[model samples]
Target: ISQGIIFVSLLIFLLVGSLNGRQRTFVSDTVENKTVVEKSVTDYLASKFNTMVIPSLYCIVLLIGLPANALALLILITKTKITPSTIFLINLTLADLFFILLLPLKISYHFLGSNWLFGEALCRIYIASFYGSITCSVFLLMSISIDKYFAIVYPMFSRSFRNRSKATFGAIVIWILALFSIFPFLLSQQTLYISDVNITSCHDILPREEQNSYYFHYFLFLVILGFIVPFLVIIFCYISIIWTLSMNARSQFRAKMLSTLVTITFLLCFMPSNVVLVIHYSEFHASNHSDLYVSYMVCLVLSAFNTCIDPFVYYYISDEFRDKVR
Candidate 1:
């Protein structure tokens, strides 16, 4: 049954990835005086489709993730052995819970047709927590992969790395790094200003050129540092672990299963958004009205829901908590 669920989840991820890849976007023409451009109705439909999913996912996060993560936290904190591995799970649950707690602010914003009913202060804090939790989650997952690598592949060296003190320190470092990383969003983003349209949006409200420049630089950094570097580390660690396990008398099945789950989780939860980001930033400077707007919405929804799926990842891979769930 667990294997079936894992397979279905992978299939869902692949479907989402394929759909994202098929999305058509509009890049601006360099020609002079091209104010109006053609936009496919299909792109518009895709945007609406993406936006629709956000609320459904919001329901899951609120109705399902919140309680599940909260319960998991109780279990991990009160019952489970406080190994470095479990410490990371605890941090993961905390991040998920923190992010889930902030979902109403976003759901309300989106349900109101992208209007920011919450004032500027919350806009900043909520957005910070949003980005901060996500960054923390990714790096923590990377840390988990690192922990498992040592534990499964190098048992002798694993002990030195698995202490409670070091994991706590690592958690603090991840939080601090995430906090600083999102600091720029608070200062730079502002409510959209348009005299004609009395609605405020909570993102880059700058001129097209300026916003694109800022997004391009930062998105590039995230792709490299946030996704790519962590990805390479995870792949290397898991590959080595798998190689070592195959040579050992142990089943090696669980190690392979965990690595597969991790890799698929990253691909589904992180890779699509990262790819969309690269495409979005590259063409953001050159986007026309129709296609550009739709693509933006799709990217936004995908990025926001990235954290929403972490619960499933936790449930599937963590042996310590799996039995507790049953």
Candidate 2:
């Protein structure tokens, strides 16, 4: 988990640093005759249309995922013997459910051609909802890995110390951390003004000069807290688990299987965002020619895809889920 956090933190720093880098103008001779503001609007409309495609697909999955996850949560709660891992999964699913609920607002924002009809307060809530979902997902995954680490490597100690109450407390702590981490979106400047066309946008609309600073700081923080830290912990736990299982040939196969699943889960959920973030940063800082905003839109789509893929990963990788299905 800590390794994941570190990875995310580095990407965020790269993005934020790029944002604070020297400003590059997007306008060229061809763009000059047209209203820059209107062009921005038009670009946004096109981007919005593109953004709608993935989220719409995701909404369908969420439709299935939310209820399934809810049922799973209920089952876990009713179990006579509940594990710490179940506690983490419950919170993870809860966050995902909330995430699913917010998808409509996001989808609608794009469907309406990038015009944020939801106003400032809702805009803030929208951003927070998205950020909170993402942060909670990362932290909860980390917590699960930690629980697995203890269960496998220190079974008796875990039985004594990692009981239901501690598990619930851990989940609470992760949620609180996520809530605090994403609160900044609530305080951020969400509206962008176009002086040339008398219009406003709900996207992070810092001025050109300030945009870089915002990105630099935001990216740096995310890299540290979001990716780097979580990834490290996840990797460390898995390593210990693998080592412990390997000492006994009977469990070696299971350890390998679990390691493979964990790797696939992390790669599917986090790797795309990491790559997209890097590309987006490059595009942001590129001087004369690149379409940075387009790059950002692409990254945004990838991030959303990450959100959608999570439920499937959860279903497939969870042994508890499989047991229940049987």
Candidate 3:
């Protein structure tokens, strides 16, 4: 396993090195030709990141995520009894499955040098489904954490509040909210023909004026609704749960691991992109320059990893799942 990790790492480094050089040459050649700079050189960083990193990361996510999420769903249904937690877990697993299923199209898009051959309509649906699944997963994780928090922190009083019907209702609300979050993106155009690059770039390239006028505000709204709100709720719930667990009894390893893993993965996957997005849109919107947009795109690669790591999160949270896996 370690050998495989090392091998993938080395392969990525090689791809990054070769692709970056080629990108630099592409820029120089374009400049020499005196063709209008269709896209800036910094934009190439995102392109390079997409070409080298997205395919590899997404491939790994696809390979592991498909079977992991599928098995998680199967186990939750067959091996575990129905309950609030089970309902939430099942929904969460389904959310991850939705996210994972969309990755192959993304992998192909990036591997083809960011040319989105899927046409405009498919691109819209693709982006919508991508963000929708992720947003739903985030809210569902918060729901699960809250369920755990109440069950652990106030077991007696929490009984009425936590039930299968309530869980199902929460899942429905989460899915609706997720769809709402990405609705603006779905309605907007996502494909652009770059005459210089001679490719139809997906959401990566958009008209500067439209981005500044519309997308900047829309994406910032997304950051608040999708990332900020859910994260704060989940973090607070986890902290309270941790303290309660530590204070009332001996620290449970699995419980604590679940908390730590969720927190770390949430921050690792979403924080960078969210932060960079806010900064880039706020500061660079009018300038029409690539202010950390490459970094933003690169950070997005980490977000897809959340789906890959989510099934393992089920392992830590569910005793039935743990035993079944073991």
Number of the top TM-score candidate = 3
Q: Which lDDT tens digits does candidate 2 get at residues 1-326?
A: 43454466557655654553222223222244432443553464446344576456656655765676666666656742466777787788788778877878776665655557767888888888787787888888888889889999999987888888999998999888888877677887676545453444565344444445556566557656886678778878877887888778868766666656665566555654554444444456445322444544555555455545554555544677656656
Residue-wise C-alpha lDDT for candidate 3, range 201-255, written one tens digit per residue: 6677665556556776887788888788877787777777777777544465555
Clashing pairs in 1: 28-286
Q: Give me candidate 2's TM-score against the actual structure.
A: 0.78
Best by lDDT: 3
What's the TM-score of every candidate structure? 0.80, 0.78, 0.84
Q: Flag regions of model 1 displaced more than 4 Å.
A: 1-53, 248-250, 289-296, 299-309
Q: Each candidate's lDDT (Cα)? A: 0.66, 0.64, 0.74
* Model 1 alpha-carbon miss at residue 288, Å: 2.2
Error of 1 at 267 (Å): 0.8
State the displacement of the C-alpha of residue 198, model 2, in Å, after optimal TM-score superposition: 7.6
